[model samples]
Target: MPGQVTLELDPSLFGEREKRVAHSGKLVATAFRYKSGVAGLRVDNGAGTVTLLPFQGQQVWDAVFFGRSLTMKSMFDEPQPTRDYLRTYGALFLHCGGTSMGNPGPTDTHPLHGELPNLPHTDAQLVFGEDEAGAYLDLTGIARDAKAFHHDFVSRPRVRIREGATSLDMAVDVENRAGKPLPFLYLAHINFRPVDGAVLIDSVRDDRADATVRQPHLAQDEDEAVVAYHRAIAADPSSHRTLKAGVPIQPELVQTMKAAGAADGWTHALQRHPNGSGDFVSWRPDDLPYAVRWLTRGPDQDALGLVLPATAAPDGLAAATANRQIVWVAPGAAYRTSFRFGALDPAAANGLEATIKTIRGG
Candidate 1:
């Protein structure tokens, strides 16, 4: 018995942009026919919008602005790979890994699930969940082994919107619907493209890490010193038994956040300017702790989608847990977390500093 709302999208907004079925107004996922084989998501609550490029050789892609497109050929730099089922971006929710428990797979293979490696106990799922309302997905008979979809590969998720409003409120339910005791990791992979000067603001860390190079295998490079630091944290008994801090704001990354209406490089925090509308917000889940930051800046950056991952765990589940960065949940349990996205003109407003103070109640 949760309150719901619907999403409204203008097809004309992006010509040839195919629209997905709008359930109860919580989400409207759109696909561009003539563009980069990308899809965009519009949540009902003004929480902010996200875009995904399923064909851009990446698992996820995101952006704040709309209408901009990248060429498919320009993206992968090769002829069309398998146009068949390329697992681009969409909300990914499932128990993925190649292990049972106690032992986990390598960080690179963490997202891919199977048996044999005896991966760590990890569960990761992403779906719009309830704020102050109730649950979103009606988990009346969701079987743990049940295929996410009936016949169609894409999940036919359900949602509802009460009155016609510009915003949306939805629910996402996670339970131990599986028969066996399930161990897993959950995350909302909100991917964002890093435009030059695009400052990312989050307080998920107590101490700021100098901008680290993002390696393909892990969130950060495999520096001997960094690995040693992680090992030390893992050995600490006073920590939370996970590798996350959960601080949602950072000033150094902000210096790297790029401005809007740009073609390359990074943007400083989007201040309320004479011509700009500053809007940014995030969540502070008590369970998840570590936050991730990433940006792939290059001439073909647009062709290659980037991820400024704001995570609650560092690296993979095993590493994260070792560092005391895990969210423990009781069996047959349910919880909710939410954030807001709105305008805060930095020039006219208190700038990024004022906005952070407002969000943190500082």
Candidate 2:
């Protein structure tokens, strides 16, 4: 059986000099606190390091492999202890949704991307164990979202890293406490920093004709250039696959795609850089039927969000309901999803490209 240790949130225990808490072979787990008083956990698996914010919805703040950072560049330098999404929006991997997800409609009142991101967790711990593959370390936390006499649910999010590995695995389970069927929506907002001249390989067709553009509701004061760009993508959805330097894909360009799974029922996506390095993600299409491609390039912020797996599009509650995309969980039942994100070396990147080609029946 795996052993668990409750994390002690004492400031002194996690000071700048006293961060390391546990060590086994080449794996090390450390707990620390940000200057803003938010608690965080960091794990180093010899090849890379990942910092997780256990207090703030267990979001991944940073991931570095072989001296290359995988996290996107944002205006904010550190995570803030606020509920405002924009203020604390910088994360490598952000979990979005609960009962409702996405931007609220004209009559909807839920916050943007639901109430999961930046929501504080009630408890957190470290779980360590060894399996057939090897030794592993896990950082787990409990988060709940409820209202007075309304929908109530709990979510347990975990991040795991194995010895001397460059990859990270994420899993979450959400259980409904309400006595009736509970509506649910979820999106894994895995953001990767843009690398110029990187080729995107995914389960979707390489051509633009196979994609569908989803226009988000823009404000009256939205930039005209952005609006025009959206129109361009809507006119030709296939033109949004490649990443070019200095070419602005401002605001955001979102496209809905029908993912093609491999023999094992999992879909793979990779952003292979010009230098033969890459970043990849893998998930089961059955667990998340919809794949959304999000891209935003600006002077202050740049993100290449490839293959954002979700139950439905982020078009708010009314639109999802109208489209019949809402997933319902029975009373006392749970909804679960898992995915993998990692950095790939030259050989690994080439191997993945070949595997992707095979999956595409090339």
Candidate 3:
């Protein structure tokens, strides 16, 4: 049997339980009050606590072990399109760059640096049974909204626990419930902040064969930034500079990366500090063909809080769909992408080889 746990949201425990989840315990689950009928789930894994608000399972907001530290600056739980929308749809964007309607991307980010459709919208159910079979949350309703009017949206999700494992699964479904067919965009904007003193660890999965980098808009200039970024990367083949600091990928480069892998797809990985106490961010693309790699640097940016976001489509939803960049679905379509947030124990450091073998289960 898995660990037995109970769920509820009691404000009195706010300081005691919620605060401790991020820095003390192995894990804890509690549902906090957000708005009408919408409950936010907070889980602590000692190193940090994660808050997941499942309004109809559309996941309006997600803040990890560090409390709402980052979201407080930009990712607030306001209405989608506007804070007031919360009264109408029970959904909100929580961030500056999310939408309420459309075929939200299957994952987040593309190599070409484009955007996906909207997040999932559907009628989902919450489960509170036992074990894997007892695990709750059925996103079937969201998966079945491909052909109908495509309007009303809801998200139902589940939190599963095992030793040293934390996983979040959710489904977004929208029912037209209106007269006309609904066309929208979806993207998972998963943002995480690295520990205060960590540096970016480059991996083989993020290699660029051509002299051309995938995106350039993120750069200070289109023509000059592209040339300099590529040149810096090329000159530093020995060191890790696949993406030069303080430069953004251009839009055209994003387009090129989209076309190259839209048919097949790719994977991106990052490693946290070798001796640190956190997990790396990983995402997989299911429906969208493209993946974008974004790096933010400046006096304004943090030395530790980096971003590795994934988008299903490139550009905005309108452009992705018009350019046939967005993947379409028949009636009753559903998509899912899974991520593992793993932490290394101090003992695992002493027995690095043994830990590796155990992770491999050999």
Candidate 4:
């Protein structure tokens, strides 16, 4: 059980804005809404709309584009998409799998993905401002993961979205508030509904697994999941045997992957839309050296996830720590990282390669 604590909202720490502590009304700024077992917040940055669960890992539950939403509504049975059912029911709470992702074996009782996703967040504040670059909304939140007499860690997340920008930027600082050193594994789970013609592409070769788990062909409005394991460390995301097709996840069924061993030099990954539109995710490789791709392509509970991890793998605390893949923070030290997600629809006549190179500025 984690203890609760209050925190101050420091707009000044973010540095100078083009205007004063500029603010916007909820219509154009940020608003907090109530949802089942959690509090949902929406940020409308003029160019796009982002709805997230502030108390629940600040998970970005929905990304609305044009008129359709780009995220999955977890309950597969419901054909219609609505916020009420999503907030109250099981929606994708995408976040970093606590210290790991895999089964930690029987000795450890931690469930898949660790304690971070299910834990609640606290001390939240929303602010809007503009700089010379653009208008933006910023959400500041503080939360903790701890046991009654064990480790206590606090994470401060600064999420920003700019006006006229299709992407979201998140910078989080995590610290060990406890008295002893802490070992940790971290992975970001950003899930989106499968879009027609959407494919995953990356800059580096992947180190993939040898094991494969195939799924059944599902009809529209049906749900299923299977994972393909990568036993060897290869090149990057694109090289994994399961992803060699380089095609958008089949929209007809559910699919998932658990591959590890990331490579260097690549800073971003791209998901291209059939209409020539696409999404790009960029991060500091030093902070997030690894990544994972999960496509819950079930027509009923559709979600295409691009997981960027701060460790080598999402296996679990015991496995990662044992392999020296987990990062350790001293009692008085802090760990920090940031990543950006945005979309681009270049007018180029080039294919996926050209689209990818343009997004990454290669």
Candidate 5:
């Protein structure tokens, strides 16, 4: 069996350096806790470091590639308790939904973005292994959402990063333990900070007809200026490809896109920064048929959510049901999806851009 260690929260170990460095060409994982008592795990893969918050929905809290930060900016300074979702919502990768996601309907009782964000895991472990591909570190956790006589399900989420790599691979296997079939909604809320002059690239059609702007209900009371921005997006979805540093995407701009998959059945989304560097994510379109573009460029928070893969748009449970967009999982059945988030240097970015152009037939 591969070596494994159970995660524990220890404030005394906070900010301690990783004595077992990855200099030997092996992946390293260190567990620590923040001053707020939130548990975290840091994994070093020689080329980059990723912080995982096991106690807080197993979110990828922060990621740094070769001293460059690839995460979004937020008001929160550190991670907070699971109940304080919004207060500690500045993670690089956040897993949303499982049972229910998005804003709740007027009479609905579920919390915002479902019960996954900041939801504590029942148990988590760090497993070290060497495969044909390379040495890798795996962070696995089990979380559950249940209600009496209603629905019960377990989500097993795993995040893996290999040695000498700047990418993280994520997969979630959700099992329905309820007595009957259950409806499911899922979204990978990946938040990548925008770089000035970065151009957005994705596998979605660039035509306005292939996109639909769905204004978030929470932003309905915005001022006229923000409302006009939404109108601009509706009129020309292609405008979303250009990113500026100081623009305002207050509340957010939610656009549902008609995505196309490559010959290998994977969809690609990337932000090619002006310096020739970039951040990208790739996922299987078959598993997540719906692609959403979420951008929030407020004063305090600036994020370019390149591509959000989901079983359905974040239109609340009621709307999804009415539209028959929710995915149904049979009792004792499981649903699985995987994606990769990586940083690219100039050369790699150039090569990827070429490939994307070829795929787009440009």
Candidate 6:
């Protein structure tokens, strides 16, 4: 009833077909190839194509639809992270920040983002099977993050793309391997490129959370040529208040989800893609209550990234802990969460309201 709402879709054609996965020039199988230190795998599940980077933080480097990329890659020409670590950017990857994404908050000793991007997955697997969808393919990997005396954690990611479908799903499981309760942060650092003239539209189910706008106007900062544009958006008033972006609220009654676990309830958002379609990413609100938008619309770099995290703001470990926004994993325990990425045809309907109703189904 507020703002300009526009969305469209065809639910009936959301057809049921057997999915598939394969390697380059081959069907019903998978393989790994490398160029220098970079390694990647080609995945085609009948409908779309995905290139998975096994060595580059175990992320999907490309998700292609209709012979075009629906995902964004950083403008940093180089495909992999450099020796400097922080310069390692781009590709629709995971955890640009890390288990501790964001700025070196209060007790940060690592670089910006985190070490996850450069940390290679020591173990992995590729498998194909026939499920309810008839046929499917997925790649699973296990990576560990253990500091000498800090925190020891494990990440298990399984990426799945269905055959004849315009979508991909990533299911990640994180475990605290330390003896004492350890703090944790997780984000699906999704980046999209060529967003120079892209129109972005997102909705808040509750109310608009205070969004901390970065220096969006500055193409470059005094220190270094500004490399990116980003925004930290809260899912609820509680977390927004902690950023001092707004007034205070009853701490207990409010859903400071970033601080707590996403035990129940969920949140969703849709964006009119720069490629004439729509890209939608949704997650359990209790798991990733905060959303961050990184736009690379600068003179130096050109791209856009949407980071939905289990915690609020990739500011740092200290700020998250202080705001009670950290996802605390009990000693020797684990947690699991997932997010969905799919494309829709906004032109299916005549106008925005019809589009929204068609996709959401009224």
Task: Work out candidate 6's RMSD over C-alphas.
Answer: 11.9
Task: By lDDT, rank the candidates, best first.
Answer: 2, 5, 4, 6, 3, 1
Task: State the displacement of the C-alpha of residue 187, model 3, in Å, after optimal TM-score superposition.
Answer: 3.4
Question: What TM-score does structure 3 among the candidates reach?
Answer: 0.51
Tens digit per residue, CA lDDT, model 4, 119-159:
56656666556667655677678788887676778877777
In candidate 4, position 175 carries an lDDT of 87
Candidate topping lDDT: 2
State the displacement of the C-alpha of residue 342, model 1, in Å, after optimal TM-score superposition: 7.2
Candidate 2 Cα deviation (angstroms), residue 255 = 1.2
Clashes per candidate (backbone, < 3 Å): 72, 1, 65, 14, 0, 12
Residues 1-362 of candidate 2 have per-residue lDDT tens digits of: 64543454433555544368887778888877788777777888888888988778889999999798899999978888998888888899989988788778887888888878887887777777778878888888788888867688999988888887788889989999999888899999899998988888886864465466766667788777667767767776655556777776666777777777888888788999999989998888899888887889888889988878889888788878889999899999999999988889999989988887787673
Return the number of clashes found in candidate 6: 12
lDDT (Cα) of model 4:
0.54
lDDT of 1 by residue, 1-362 (tens): 23433233332333455555343344444434434323233333223343322222222222232232111111433222222222322221111221122123365443332221111111212243355453342111121223332111111112222222211222223444434433444433332332333333433222223223222332454445444444443354113112232211111121111112112211222212233433333334332222333222223322111222222333455664576544443445533333222234345335554444443332
Question: In candidate 2, which residue pairs get closer than 3 Å at backbone N, Cα or C atoms, i.e. clash?
Answer: 208-238
For model 4, the superposed segments whose C-alpha errors exceed 4 Å read: 1-27, 30-37, 76-93, 99-103, 206-266, 348-362
Task: List where candidate 1 sits over 4 angstroms from the true fold.
Answer: 1-109, 112-171, 179-181, 204-279, 299-311, 340-353, 358-362
lDDT of 6 by residue, 1-362 (tens): 12211211111211233223234222243344443345556676676667776545677777777666866544454456453444655566565444566667546776766666566776666655445654455677778888877888887777766666666777887788889877777767766543333344433333343344433232333323222101223223312221121111111011222211222454444455445566556566566777665544434444455335445676776787678877778977887877776565656212432333333332
Query: Per-residue error at 88 for model 1, in Å?
Result: 2.3
Using all chains and alpha carbons, the TM-scores for the candidates as numbered come to: 0.45, 0.92, 0.51, 0.70, 0.91, 0.71
Error of 1 at 164 (Å): 11
Residue 291 in model 4: lDDT: 59
Error of 6 at 87 (Å): 2.6
Query: Could you give candidate 3's per-residue lDDT for residues 24-121 as a string of tens digits?
Result: 23545555554443445565544454455433333435434323233312223332322232232222122112222222344523222111122332
Q: Which segments of model 2 are wrong by more than 4 Å?
A: 2-12, 16-18, 206-210, 216-232
